[model samples]
Target chain A: MMVMTQENLTSKERFDKIFEVEFLPQIDALYTFAYHLTYNEDDANDLVQETYLKAYRFIEKYIEGTNAKAWLFKILKNAFINQYRKKSKAPTKVDYEEIINFHDEENDTNYSTHTDLREEMFQSMMGDEVTNAINALPVDFRVVILLCDIEGFTYEEISKIIDVPIGTVRSRLHRARNMLKGQLKTYAESLGFKDKRSKD
Target chain B: DYQELVRKVTMYLDNELSEAEAYLKVLSQEKSFREFIKSKLHRRKPSPALIKSIKDKIKT
Candidate 1:
């Protein structure tokens, strides 16, 4: 959080300083988020560009010393919701029951044997799979999870950014995690790492 | 019970709970829960290429 003295500098100077100091460091994180939300590289770039342009135009109104990332995220989230997400639907839907039943079928496989391999394999596989699973979440859940889990924002910060109550953030994060866990479980089973503890 | 367990594990994973409380809650769970927490805590970061693309976009 960098503070700009409103009285000391010209508006353009202030904007440039803020952009250089506060916004630039967070650009990568913001783009990653936009990319995940849009699921298209080009669209993600455009969305992030638009977000920055809006943030710059409205720069004078932004209070100094506030959470810059959250402010930027608010701008980005609103842009995504009002403009982009409204025009698109999820590419696919996965049934949780089907995943669970599939895990049940693989109950005979041993988890312990794969526990060592699990770490390395999962580490390599998780980034793409997690991104895919997150992108597949409903709009609300996806936003909440991205803010809380991926971007590492606090619940209060997310509340302010998304203009939602803290309770909603909690519930949405909970649901999102469960959905993610279900997806990961299915992914693990597909890789033949059965939950041996299920038998116990 | 499963929901409660999930909530506890999630809170613990996020470090939202106090250490003593998290320890107590986590101690009561099955071995799988512990393993789950360990795996999750150690999950890999996003790819460098993904991160690089983001940085490149931001720089432009």
Candidate 2:
């Protein structure tokens, strides 16, 4: 594994400095994204480790002072997708339009099955209910919401990270957020959030 | 029709052409949904031990 040594970031101390200064600050956010993708603490930690490992191994290729968070996220997402493909028993491509059509035909209000979300749930809703909802989405939809809504990446940036056209990103985000709207509405209605929210 | 028309107008004015329909549809759904998603799921702080573990992995 021969790595190119660029001029400025060539020295050992300089390389360490680049890793610490650029990548370390993004560890928390990277961990959150990893956890959401894997939904397991150990697996999430492993994914983050792999991301940094790859980042360091190819640091010479990384341009200085660019969007490092997005770069790291792109690596993490690619790793997760590769593993997800291995684990999934379904067909290789989890086509977004197909999934959307399937659910729309079933009139499925719920996407992910973590539906223990009740009205009292909203009273303490600052926590797992949101995660449950996000975790339930199919990976295509989930990544769009995660990258766009959660991570605050622009559609163009997310398109590049996720390696899809911007049009695909737009449609996926629309569908994903719409699916969440239905799922969260069920929880909100049960938790009296709708009524309480309206009065406020 | 009229409300959607108003919404399309607003969206067009904002140059969010792609989101006009989705935005209008979402309005009929939940008003505070975006805020809820953004605020609650902003970013969870990783455990202190995990932070140390990452630093160890990267440093050593």
lDDT of 2 by residue, A91-133 (tens): 6678799888877756655633423454456455435677778
Best by TM-score: 2
Residue A99 lDDT, candidate 2, scale 0-100: 84
TM-score of 1: 0.64
Per-residue lDDT, model 2, residue A120, is 50
Q: Which candidate leads the pack in DockQ?
A: 2
> Per-candidate TM vs. native?
0.64, 0.68
Tens digits of lDDT, candidate 1, B1-60 = 356665766666656666735444343443343354234432222445654554455444
Alpha carbon lDDT of residue A174, candidate 1?
A: 85
List the TM values for chain B, per candidate: 0.35, 0.38
Return the clash pairs for model 1, or none.
none
A20-94 in candidate 1: lDDT tens per residue? 678666777788788767765666776777777787778788886678899999998998898655565655668
Correct interface contacts retained, every candidate = 0.04, 0.47
